[model samples]
Target: MLRLAWLFVAAWVVPALAAPPDDPLRSPAWPYMAERYFAGQTVRFDAAVRVLMPGAAEDPLAVPVYVDAGALADVREILVFADLNPITTILRYEPGELARPSIGFRFKVQQATPLRAAARTGDGVWHLGGAWLNAGGGGCTTPSQASGSGLWKDRFGEIDARLWPRADGLRRLRLQLIHPMDTGLAGGIPAFYLETLALQDSDGRTLARLQTFEPVAENPLLSFDLRGRGAVSIRGRDTQANRFAGTVAP
Candidate 1:
């Protein structure tokens, strides 16, 4: 009877601790995240959707991630998030006509976590890609660089952004926005960051849009790929309602 009981308990524990079936990355948080975020939605772990990052983060507050879903067709949206972060949602990008299915940005992390990207194609299927990071942790609670000094006031809304023509016939737009991007988790600090940035064509038609959250690092360095050869403009507003705009000629 004792041996039988131990076998029963072992069977239950093994299944409970195992990763969900068909998870290639084998993240321990994938099961909970599946129902919490992608509940009732069709999600697939696809290799064509690539999420690239360094093996270890030198600065937890500025871990860089680059996602390229160019191999997937008719991608409608792409989302990047950390599974175990206090603020999970990092970025939401919709590249309509102005860009390809590739983007790069940096975000903060509280601990070693699974970083994933979900790219939804027009067929109503969501494809996934991700990688795990080895980090030192404590990135979300640190005071921002801008908060450590009054120097942020001198260059709060400055934008160093431009569009460059690539040899592969794709126009790449590289932009950097100067903001503290405080998560407000630190002592006596407030949460502030850029809310939304829109890319528009010469006719003022919105080509793509990116929505960011507090997990993004200070002075966001962003990149996007364009498929057309027309002039485009970037417009955005921060949490304080400060406006920023810049134009790029293709």
Candidate 2:
């Protein structure tokens, strides 16, 4: 009887392993991305953390992306990447205690690839959400539009930002800066972009930090949630050792 039960278990498991995966999005790049990004964590494609991108990127240079992991609680870190891009990482965010899991930004897409966001909770599990994007390619390989137009040259390191109070006492911050953010994939162009940014309060206490990467859209864009309505400053640096500092008041 024991032998028969073992055989029954094996029969059920073998076919299940042989069958195709039941991933909701059925992402073709999940296997490779899993090994590259999350090798040992429990991961599943969950709709609760929405990763919204257009079906087709009309402009590969600047494709808008929205990641809303607001439904999840105690999110430790969030990672945004493209599976097939030359430079995969777009943003690595830590919500910490003040901010929400939702963000709106733009990025570069090399070609048709899977745009993914993985949110890790306190439980040590990474929740994944993504969708395939269709593109004609060349977002990474071309010179930045801002750079080509020479606007970023005159306005380099200029940080323009706004902070607004919400009905619930939270604050919303939208920031833009002028930078080439070159990926270096394009011929003769060296990579130069904001490497790190920290959001801070009046006392210089760090609210949160964001790790920006090469694939992030040129003329860097960022949206963040502030827990308090107090004055906050955005401080950052680029690859060339240039410093950026700006204060936004309520």
Candidate 3:
């Protein structure tokens, strides 16, 4: 009958329309990134490398994220990325021999997306952790703190480093840098930030390196674990090719 034919068509069409589309975050793009970054190796889910952030970001421009890999030893590097941001890779940090395996920093969230952290071990395995952050939007394209009148004129290109003693016989190294970190999405603001950072010992041996992108918040705060050290020094350069350095003794 005509009624039976219509019902059959409706059933087929409804299911097709209702079926959810593939998640773009895990599509071909993710595989390509995995191949490039991890050399196509499998990333295992790990609870030790914890990615802690708020369920909902109150301030998308300055959302705080803490990556704790303190329990894991022999950590070579840590990488952080956002699934929905225009620039997917946010930060790449290489911890030093005596440096602690924990870091805390702030970043911009464009929208609701998965923020992932990968901790690479000495054996070349990457342990992954992720969390979702719901943002109200406009975190990337909005005006920055440096865009304000006269804010960046005198305060730019400054570095501060400090070392503190820990109960575990390790030292905690904290570094802060003054930079605008403009994302270029905002009107008339070119992308500018510290692109590379390195820590070294008194003998000029490199300890660890860091690579950062525009998603980093203005005036980045970085912490690292440090072992025995007489004097530790840091050197870095920004997008404008401005070099800065600082030293700390514990």
* Highest-scoring model, lDDT: 1
Q: Write the per-residue lDDT of candidate 1 for residues 1-250, one digit (tens) a residue.
A: 9999999999999756553446676777778888676766788889898989998889998988899999999999998888888888899999896579899999998998889899999988889998888889999999998999998889987888888889988888989998999997999998999999999988777788999999999999999988776788889998889899988775
Give the clash count for each candidate.
0, 0, 5
Stretches off by above 4 angstroms in model 3 are: 1-36
TM-score of 2: 0.87
lDDT of 1 at 14: 74
For model 1 the local lDDT of residue 48 reads 90
Write candidate 3's Cα lDDT for 4-74 as tens digits.
Answer: 99999999997565433333335435544555566645476687888899999999898989898877879
Candidate 1, residue 203: lDDT: 77
Evaluated with TM-score, which candidate comes out highest?
1
The CA lDDT at 123 in model 3 is: 85
Q: Comparing 2 and 3 by TM-score, which wins?
A: 2
TM agreement with the true structure for every prediction: 0.89, 0.87, 0.82
Whole-model lDDT per candidate: 0.88, 0.85, 0.81
Ranking the candidates on lDDT from highest down gives: 1, 2, 3
